[model samples]
Target: MNLEDLRAVRSRERSSDSLQDLRASFYEEVADYIQERKDARERAAAEADDPFSSEEVQTLTDEIETAEQVAEAIYERRMGKLVKQASLAAAGMTGDTDGLTNEERRLYEDLVARIEENKSHVLDVLAGEVEPGAEATGDDDAEPDPIDAAHANPEPGELSEPADDAVAPPDSARDESSAAAAMGGGLDGAEEPAAVDDAAVSTSRASDEEGDEAGAERTTVRITRDVGDVLGVDERQYSLEAEDVVVLPEENAKPLVEKDAAEEL
Candidate 1:
């Protein structure tokens, strides 16, 4: 199709209901027109007694190629405009919404959904960073520690189930205030030793988990046919096809795997 013809088709199909149909029809026309040219060439060659004539067809493949090129160029221009409009909507640009038609809104929502779907990778999934899901899991699964977990329900200065080897102190010698202050607290108060131990252990485990998440090496994966486009990983890009491998964090690859788009290496 010529430039004017393509524009005519697009203008007529700009409505939401006809947009998909328009794309399908454009591709079909390009394919059919190219095939028609080839068929005409073969027929013309056969008509001549000497099929291999020195005369070349002035429009040999040019019209078909041009048609294809024009179609793609139109698609790219439209796609660029739509992407910009969608971005402006996402950024909450006022007055930019003036001309957003129903068709454009649909396209805008789709683009927004795609960005949200990949948000984990865009923000948190990266080299030396923990999985985005991990952070979510950490938040969801974490339980608040009880204030009296260490020593529950104890009387003031009363030793917790006196140790086996402990000797009984003279009643007068065991002043409750001095003893409670010494142990940092009695049954009624938090045990300093127990609280300290718990805090230290919790801190240590948190540090270890942070280290594991940060030091985790990149994993490799292969894209299956389900992933019909090329994707960018941390430092490279991988085409979407079977047997194509890419290295990335598990969080970044989760959607692909869930979609049957890739398998872990």
Candidate 2:
């Protein structure tokens, strides 16, 4: 397909119902194209006394061969999708029926039944025991586990000091030192640990109260631009678009309002 035609097909692929309708029409068109190619091949054969020697015959044959190749590609794509759906259904996942109609449901069930009849090979294909086609768009490299990576790679503020002696006096030592300085005499080494504990308890209580306030307070903002996209929030892109109203935590809402990208709603 030409770029524009492929773009149009991709645009239509967003909704499931559209795909269900488009599949039949697309298959019919492919079948017709294949039939036309076969007719052309026969005509090409007749037009050349030596079909293999004639450039025109060779070109016609190539086009005819291309049509069949394209048809097979389309067929395999449909098969992959059907197999995925059937496997997911067998595994009890039925999410995202936004565009699936009753007819589509029946077709899915029929495919599932056929798959079950040859369950061994079908299961192998689904389980990646068999590579059905090498036409997948995604990188073959497996993605890293996000939760594991996050735990392994903590944020900058979360990084621990090598020791209390490193990076100046950390909060623990500073709080104790400040408390001693405020007392107009340095603390005894024995009392310094107690001073640190007291400071830690105070800090913990303050953080808990602050967290409670932030959690309890929600703010509504009218977005001037798509903050959802900027923040990489999935499925809620529309909610964070320009001129859209969204509710967020007060802590999150304050900066956007200050920047004039959003206003309180």
Candidate 3:
């Protein structure tokens, strides 16, 4: 990769780093909470003759008070959230029945699956267990991964910062220009161009013109497989892991068939 490529990669890595950093804070809080919960459970088990307390009793209440104080001292701004998270974990582990609605349960399950997939991907990346990209094959119809769509084809100005010297003109100047332009007046008394010269600039654009990358464009060949091809099941029963798939976009491609009924209307 050249300098531009390197810069692009660094930008991606920096974005990835920021995401990881945000998660790291939560991980730290989780770790500390888990440790404190374990220590309290251990201490409690050793203390009372009847270690199993009543259903009304709160486990590790004393330890939590101390943990809250310590957490506040360490992370003053985040103490509330951290303490609440730790409390929830402790409560969940101790069989304290916190209610989860049906929707919440479904969402939680989805989050768990994503977490698992991310874990596997991270390990695979670290261990060099997978190909850098997908393995090339003669087979057509292999769709690109949806997860890469956001990061794959970055647009111009997607990550650019404005120049330091940029400034806005006064509102009064902006209003005056707007008012003058609306009152059948031209800026700086500009005149209409001569008729002969105007014809040169009035060119018609072809309806089917290709975008900027006409010659060097990547082809996104559609991949179609019978249900039995990969799944070994009927086409109707072919459950898919959409997350594992890579999908490349077809340039200048329009959908042939409308998937949504509303679109037909």
Q: How many clashing pairs in candidate 1?
A: 1
Output the worst ten-in-a-row residue range by lDDT, candidate 1.
Answer: 185-194
Q: Identify the runs in model 1 with alpha carbons over 4 angstroms from their true place.
A: 1-24, 49-58, 88-110, 119-265
lDDT string, candidate 1, 33-64, tens digits: 66787776677666656656524343544555
**Model 1: lDDT of residue 96:** 33
Per-model TM-score versus the true fold: 0.31, 0.31, 0.18
The all-Cα superposition gives candidate 2 an RMSD in Å to the true structure of 25.3
What does candidate 3's lDDT look like per residue over 93-202, in tens digits? 33111333243334445544454555566666677975556443323486766655544755776753445657888975675444323222110111132223222222
**TM-score of predicted structure 3:** 0.18
Best by lDDT: 2
TM accuracy, model 2: 0.31
lDDT of predicted model 1: 0.47
Better of 1 and 2 by lDDT: 2
Candidate 2 — which residues are off by over 4 angstroms? 1-21, 95-107, 113-265
How high is the CA lDDT of each candidate model?
Answer: 0.47, 0.49, 0.33
Q: Which ranges in model 3 have alpha carbons more than 4 Å from their true place?
A: 1-98, 131-265
